[model samples]
Target: MSGIVEVAAAVMLRANGTEFLLAQRPVGKVYAGYWEFPGGKVEPGESVRQALIRELQEELGITVTECSPWLTRQFTYPHATVRLNFWRATAWTGEIGITAPLEHSAVEWQACGTAATVAPILPANDPILKALALPTTMAITMAESEGVERQLERLEQALQQGLRLIQVRDKGWPPARRLAFAEAVTRLAQAHGALVVINDDAEIARQAGADGLHLSSGQLAACTSRPDFTWVGASCHSAEEIARAGELGLDYALLGPVLPTPSHPESSGLGWPEFGRRLNSNRLPVFALGGMKNELLTAAQNHGAHGIALMRGW
Candidate 1:
């Protein structure tokens, strides 16, 4: 590897966010015929966002009206080591491949959350495809407040309504009761094709057969290796903690008290600007936590959150 080359990449999503665009590399380029997200090298004086906007206009003939930082990854190709700064482009103007001369041989929309139909995708994009499958909303169970039985009922209803990600986080419950509740949640979620993650208790997560484990901040600091779970995440409050979670290769993280919540009334929330600042150039997907509601999903995503993780609001 010589010097690191910075690249700005866009995952241009459809209006419903169920599909994203992939472009085939034009002949004569490296990895010609391989498919990848459309983007280009970042210039010295340009920010990643600026590069993204410019690249899209020049290549696809569209003006990116809305986008947000998502993930940053580095891959060492035989030719060069590229640092890919991935952004989620939600809204754009003008028709793709019409406003400007086509830069690539072809382009097509790929379905999100499923195996890609396109062949010979760039190897560096495998993890990016997986990350895009995570839902935009995560519901945290409040069994202690609602009572496990009522909570279970609510969980079933949410699942029916298409809630696919859940976190069981009642630390106050007795060990036996907590385990039972986790098991029940796992079963219910599995039935609906949803995923369940137990909070802080690896033993209980295993016993309940949950899909993953969520480490508390303390547990995150104490952990020396990634836990053996299909999906792992951590509760993070600051940039340092978020970076730590990423270093551990966790799938995602919950960051913030983006707004003041009933759970912690004394501390002021990080606010959106600060929240976005902390998440700038971060690698893993992160959900906005604390006082989050369904209506704030767009706001959260605009400020670099992959989604919102809700407790009471859900």
Candidate 2:
């Protein structure tokens, strides 16, 4: 850790909040032509948030109005090791008036979840791009309560409304019924260019052509290796479980009971403060689960959640 430099980086979003800015390193700096999230090294007395705000103001001439901790990654370069703390700046003030005063040579906004025309990106940026591509809301199925036919109708409506990530968790059904339903959901999801994850069943997920598998905490603990899927995530209730999810190289994790719910009325929820504590400095993108509504996305993001996972609200 001695030579590891701490740096703060910003994934600055435009007014639409879907595209993010990437800057080219200046002429004399390391990787001069390489593109990266705009930021600078943290000063001796600065917290990550403080450094982020300062760096963005200096580099972009914009005051960050709303930002949140996003990702933490460490990479080794020939000169030294660096731990890059990334934040997603969803709102800002002021214009990016001129480039002469900025340290970067050039900057460009690229749409998330798409290939960038910008070339020769920094080696460490591949994962960052993937993380950026992940949708901010994950919809979990509640078909058992809603009834399969009614749920399907609701799903189609949600899909048309731009709900892209889904989790099919029809545990009340028998194995055959679950598999059949999973297949139906997968087909519908694929038609709309959406991704689906089958909950708690790798085989069913695979058979249904799901994009990934979502493991229950019990399943996550019992597994020795990540299942074969394009995306794999787990339900985590504790800090240790979150760390374990990272160790398993999972794409994301859902941490929750962030608020009390009708389904689990006896259980107390981890208030936003506790939710923030559990997710502090997490390397893996995490979703706030349980008692979530669509309007709470900002609240979730402010507390370091990658997004929210909800059963009722899309």
Candidate 3:
């Protein structure tokens, strides 16, 4: 038989570093008796999104208002080959209690970072679980002016406020100014135990002793292997671009214009639904970009985004 088996899942998470829900399988099912992100097969003429909504209402008694599709993974076992699209769903109505375990044996919302230790995750879910564990934010520096001292102060301020991840995107500066700015940011990052990725200037990033490099989409596509660094990231707007980023051994990617923005006013945002669909990714970290702010974090997560890459958003 010729067939394509499709599936969907939800990573319903809370913002307080609290928890995400998982359900245990019952008897006589594929991957039976293992913990999993609750979801089911795509039914006749039903989209993955529709299947998720139906599954959530049936399994957890929670009505969803918004969902972000994030990770997509494919796995084959002795029993079956499945394509899974994962979404980050946000609850709208109905209290999320384990209403009935008729099909699902039990459900619980345990702390997120501790999932691996919980034991019994289905093998297909393991990679996505690890991807979710990584920190989801990246701060790229902006130099609207050549004032080195002023920029340093900005970097310092961001660092003080728990900005552990950063990128030195000082491209407009002439060579000497760029080097000075990178050096300053690197110093600040070190003092705060933060990691700074230099943008597109591999040589400068290396010379200034930065933590790693942030490749542009062009650079990412051209690379054959990852640069020798502690962290590597890229900027991308499409799925193919993100796949390439992963192929080059990059650690993560910032993808977007998911919302209408002045940065690219001529373009339209990805809208939450499409944004989530695009992310059904199992590759590198994909932080939603393009006109994102902190107010969208819950929405972004629900939509399948690891997090947001922002200028205004922290």
- Which one wins on lDDT? 1
lDDT of 1 by residue, 103-185 (tens): 99999899988999998999999878988888889999888988988998988988999899999999998899999999999
lDDT for each residue of candidate 2 in 1-314, tens digit (9 for 90 to 100): 36789999998987666799999988888888999999889999899988998998898887888889887888898877999888998887877745327777888989988998798799888878888878889999988888889888889999999998999998888889999989999999999999899999888998999999999999999989988898899999998898888888888999999998889988789989999999876778999998999999999999989999989967
- Per-model TM against the reference: 0.95, 0.95, 0.75
lDDT at position 252, candidate 2:
92
The true-versus-predicted C-alpha distance at residue 270 of model 3, in Å, is 7.9
- TM-score-sorted candidate list, best first: 2, 1, 3
Any idea how many clashes model 2 has? 0
Least lDDT summed over 10 consecutive residues: which range in candidate 3?
Answer: 94-103
Per residue, candidate 3 scores C-alpha lDDT tens digits across 1-314 of 23657887887777554467778887888667789898888888998789888888887777777776666777786777778888777555776664533357777677754545455878888666656555666676776443667667776787788677777886887888788888888888899877788999888898888988888888877888888886788888787888787667567888888988866788888887887677665466688887887677777776667787876544
Best by TM-score: 2
Q: Give each model's whole-structure lDDT.
A: 0.93, 0.89, 0.76
Which stretches of model 3 miss by more than 4 angstroms? 92-98, 105-115, 134-136, 143-146, 159-164, 172-195, 201-212, 228-230, 246-249, 256-285, 290-292, 295-305, 311-314
